[model samples]
Target: MKISELFYSIQGEGKRAGMPSFFIRTNYCNLRCMFKSGNLCDTSYTSWHPDDDKNLGETSIESISDKYREFLCKDIVITGGEPTMYADELLLLCKKLKKVNKDSFITIETNGTFIGEFINYTDLISLSPKLKSSVPFDTPQKKMHDKSRINLKVLRKYNSLYKAGKLNIQWKFVFTSGEDIKEIKSLQSEIRFKNENVFLMPEGVSEKDLKKTRPETVKACLENNYNYTDRLHILIWGNKRGV
Candidate 1:
């Protein structure tokens, strides 16, 4: 599969926040989220607007699994610029991981734009469906990103996976302000997400930026009974890659 950096880092967001994990960050993305904090998406190194391509390559599942095992961690994160774009490769990687370590905890960080059957092997679907705050106006990429960002039909399929104990899931939205609270409410009304599964994360790539956005995001989570997570990696390591 086409790949980016692979490293051992603490899980920084969603339900698995702050846990020891191995990350296989795939190269490339389907959407370019212009975060409300005025920062480009933090994973841009693996993106179309790539900053450093040192980690870019095509490697086998054997190599990936061996590196993940080398870390000796129970948790593994299959992340991306958009990992679902590599559905077949991801499927094979998951199969290899499961065969090697049946008790492995796996998380797939995604924009919720594309999903494939291999996801059934995941332990948590860390689905961050892009909020309107991510949308940029008057751009072709915007239209493509907007169209690909949400699908209730696809979400329902994931809900079924959750219900059948195939995996856990979280509706993790990057919260920019109170307006996003209203949008999250509207989305929940459609999907009927359990309040417990809803997570609100402050938008930013640096500690300073996260500080500025936390208050509004915190208020939204408190008032709505949703879970809140800090971006532990950003707080600890700034925006540096290969954490």
Candidate 2:
């Protein structure tokens, strides 16, 4: 797999938040997420500036699984710039992880733009479909990002699998403002995902900014009956890599 970094850390958001987990952060993203407030994606090194001193060029699946075994962790999170971009490699990696320890839970975080073989094996699908708030300003990637961010077909399929018990999925949105809530409502109506499976996390990488946004985010979650998740890693460790 083409990897950026692999380490052990607690899941920072979503349903599995606070769980100590092994992380496999993939390299390259199909989108460049820049919020209107000028905040870039938390892991922009894996996305917008992917090659800036962090690329761990293509490692073998065996090597990855071996590292996980060394970590002695129960949960493995395959996050990304966008994991599905390397679809076949990701599927192979997940298969190796399962083979090593079938009981170990695997979570794949994605932008919800693509579906892959890894879908069948992942225990949790952390789907963060980019909202209008994620669109970057005055950049060449803006057009591509806006055009490819939301894929209803993929979202509907995830919803179907979740309802049928074939998949465990959660819709995680980066809550920025009331506009985000409006978009989430419209999306939920279209995708018909379980309201209880929806999670709204305030969009920020720093404790101060996250603290500033939490109340409004919590308020929105309360009104919509959606679950509110905090960026536990940021709050606990500040904004830095490798936990």
Candidate 3:
């Protein structure tokens, strides 16, 4: 698999929040999104703009899975840049991780732009569809990202999987303003995902920004019946990587 970084950390969001988990952040992204606040997507290092410092490269599934054995965590989170970008490799990698710990809860964090059969074997699928708030300021990139980011077909596929008892799913959305609630409501009407499975997270890359935005996010979640989750890693270790 083409991995950016693999490490163990407490899961910072979703149904598995607070659980000690292994994080496999894969390299490359289909969309070039940055927060409206000008903070680049938190995983930019794992995105199309690869960080020279990390120097992400390919490694065998057995090698990466061995790290999980070392960490001894029960949950494995395969996140991105966008994991579905490497669906074939991920399928092979997940199978190896399962060999290491069959009981492990394997979670995949996705942008919901790509639908893959690989998701069938996962324990949890956290779908974060890019919102208008994620559109970048650069004109051409913004146009491209806006054009390709939200794929209703993929979302419906995930919704169908959940309703059919084939998938355990969470629809995660990032928000910066109370106005964003209207956007979520509109999407909820379309997908009809379980309300509790819809998680609303504030758009922030640092502890201070996250704390500042928490109050309004709490109100929005309360009124909308959406689960509110903060990025615990930021609170515990700022926005530094390799946690």
Candidate 4:
């Protein structure tokens, strides 16, 4: 499979926060998001630019397991430029990881577009759906028409996972503008899951960028009884990859 980078780090978000885990960040993303200033960017790696061919490296499942065994972590996180982009490979990889350590916990961070394919193998799933504000300003005219439709399909997949006894899934919406928050609330009404499983993550590549969205939003989530997730990797690495 095409992998961007892999390393051992604490899980910085979702239900497995602060756990010592191995992160496998795959390369390539299907979604190109527009930043607040109207710039187009890939949502794969938080720091990658849309125009840059930042394909770092690639490795097979055996190599991944070998590296993880050397690193000695009990948990593994499969993330990517949309990890679901390679569901078949990932399903096989997860099976290998499970055999390596039967008690190990496996989590997959996804953009929520391809849940149906990976549900059985995934132990924990973190679903982050792009909001309207995440649309790239310079999106090619050809791709714009399908982008909106795909986003809704992704949300429907997320709701389906929850209804299928997969409540361990966490819905994380990256909030940019206040309007993003409003949209997320509307999504909550649509999905109608328990508030505790919902999380609001500020859409930022660094701690400073995240703070620009304001701590008040976290307070707002608390006031309204939703979970707030801080991107610990961003806070510590400042948009750096392979943490």
Candidate No. with top TM-score: 2
Q: Report the C-alpha lDDT of model 3 over 150-232, residue by residue, as the tens digit.
A: 89888999999899999999988887887678877777889887788889898899988898788888889899899999899
Error of 1 at 156 (Å): 1.9
Q: What is the lDDT of candidate 1?
A: 0.84
Candidate 3 C-alpha error for residue 243, in Å: 1.0
Better of 1 and 3 by lDDT: 3
Every model's TM-score:
0.94, 0.97, 0.96, 0.86
Per-model tally of clashing residue pairs: 0, 0, 0, 2
Q: Write the per-residue lDDT of candidate 2 for residues 143-175, one digit (tens) a residue.
A: 999999999998898888889999999889999
Candidate 1 lDDT, 1-243, residue by residue in tens? 888889998999887888899999998888877865567788877764764448758888998888877876899998888998988888889889998799998888887767797887888888888888887665668888777778778777777777777768888889887778888788778877789998899889889989988888888888999999889999999999888
For each candidate, the alpha-carbon lDDT, in order, equals 0.84, 0.90, 0.85, 0.73
RMSD of each: 1.5, 1.0, 1.3, 2.9
- Candidate ranking under lDDT, highest first, comes to 2, 3, 1, 4
Model 4 TM: 0.86
Better of 2 and 3 by lDDT: 2
Clashing pairs in 3: none
Model 4 ranges off by over 4 Å: 37-56, 141-154
lDDT of 4: 0.73
